[model samples]
Target: MKPFVKWAGGKTRLLKEIEQRLPADFDEWENVAYVGPFVGGGAVLCHMLEHHNNITRVIINDINDVLIEAYRFIQDDPGPIISGLKEMESIYNALSNEEQKQMYYTSRKTFNDMDGIDCQKIILFLFLNQTCFNGLYRENTKGEFNVPHGKYKNHRILNESNLWEIHDALQTVDILQGNFETVGRRLLREHVFFYLDPPYRPIVEKGNMFTMYDRTGFNDSHQERLKEMCDYIDRRGWHFMLSNSDSRSSDGQSYFDNLYNGYIINRIEVTRFINTYNATQRRPKEVLITNYQPPQQ
Candidate 1:
């Protein structure tokens, strides 16, 4: 569903490479299922709906609360929510610099302290995402959205047509928030296609690997656990694909090497874009690891 929110580690850029690795008779498979354990921006989910209508059901899970909330809102009340967001956008656009600053802080304060599904919570979440630095979702120890206002003042908070399309796509899917391991256990069906896009191990030099937004960073140990999980799934004969950083870090040899050494793997180069305050540090490279063997033409 176009990812209900903008996630820091989203893989919207790698959709084409990911699509290329799908099974040839993917549509013929009965009871086809798409499971994303760590569904971020849901770029893959949206892409699947647009391209692969054969998928009977989709299961999306995440550990982030705000993200789940946004997704649930879209699934249940997309029309009203989109309208509200558009109204909010208009209001936000009309505000002066000081007013915008005031709105950000006020919304942040209310969201941090409150613990209910009210208009305020949803509005605050939308406001923060629209105004936050690069639409980055960062939270403190107390689970407060703390990113500063971004430079873009005319952000599109809501797209009605897209929301309508996403809502239709979501009708055939189930959404949840929890650990990936749990998702693995609950999924009993065979021939399911799983796309695992966990947080990538950072390649930046001044790597504050553990950031406020991502408190539970995907470390070497977690990567090992993921390897084990994928192995277990492989034994069960379920088709799956995984994506991660191709380069190595202080942790170990490229994430692809450590995780999918014995499994069928393919390398695809993707153009990574980074338009932040420091624009000079952006570049692109190949991201590795996969299990699906696409048919040769």
Candidate 2:
């Protein structure tokens, strides 16, 4: 089970590190409610659902409302999306590279204009992600989809079998849009295991890191607020393991180390696959913080 979209911070490469750090007795925990506060590409969510049968209930939340809606459309019915994507793929792949670039820009305008059928909006969302530069979902101050064309000669706009598989997997889960805090607040009484992959704090200078998932980018204050949420989860006796960028700030201060002072911080060397103009930043680092030590440890 793979993510339907290519997200910037998707955890596909770090899945091994995350799997190793899960609660030692996770398999034994029956009737578990699995919660993902920031389900970007849903790599971990799909992993949990495929490997663990103990998760009786599943809930995921994301700040991007349109992304959440696309998930919903997939969960409910993927026939329309599949058909639309097939047509788009046929048209795009037959075109020359120059024509494909022009088509990409036109689609971007239509997506940003946002005055089309609801179903078309979702279709364009997937189209842009598959063909956009580096699979980025960035927005301008006006909340526009502004990523440039990828100019690829070949495209995989439609993955029919994968879409059907994803649709089947999503049937058992509840998808939510809005703040991450709301997921725990409503399910406080349930025994939940949260795997958080919030927008990481930038490890490099401005205009380098891909932090703009939505119109309102996550800043330092938002990182502090997320730490408070993690504290709330810990206090409630809920299990959680979070992933974030591990690079230090300009002053050589460990920001996450200071924020999650009491938690167990595991620094893991990682190589990201996302396309970047600067090749030097390809091999970045990440940290995994868990409230309780994993059984493997």
Cα deviation of 159, candidate 1, in Å: 1.1
TM-scores, one per candidate: 0.87, 0.95
Worst window of 10 by summed lDDT in candidate 1: 272-281
lDDT agreement with native, every candidate: 0.71, 0.85
Off by over 4 Å in 2: 188-190, 204-208, 275-279
Model 1, 1-297: lDDT tens digits are 466667665678777777777887787887778889888778888998788767787899877767777777777777667767787789877888788778777777877889866655776787678677777877666666778877556667776887787777777778888777767556677778888887665554335443344445456677678888788777878888887655455665555665577776676655544332122344534454556567652
lDDT of 2: 0.85
**Candidate 2: worst-modelled 10 consecutive residues by lDDT:** 275-284
Predicted structure with the largest TM-score when compared to the true one: 2
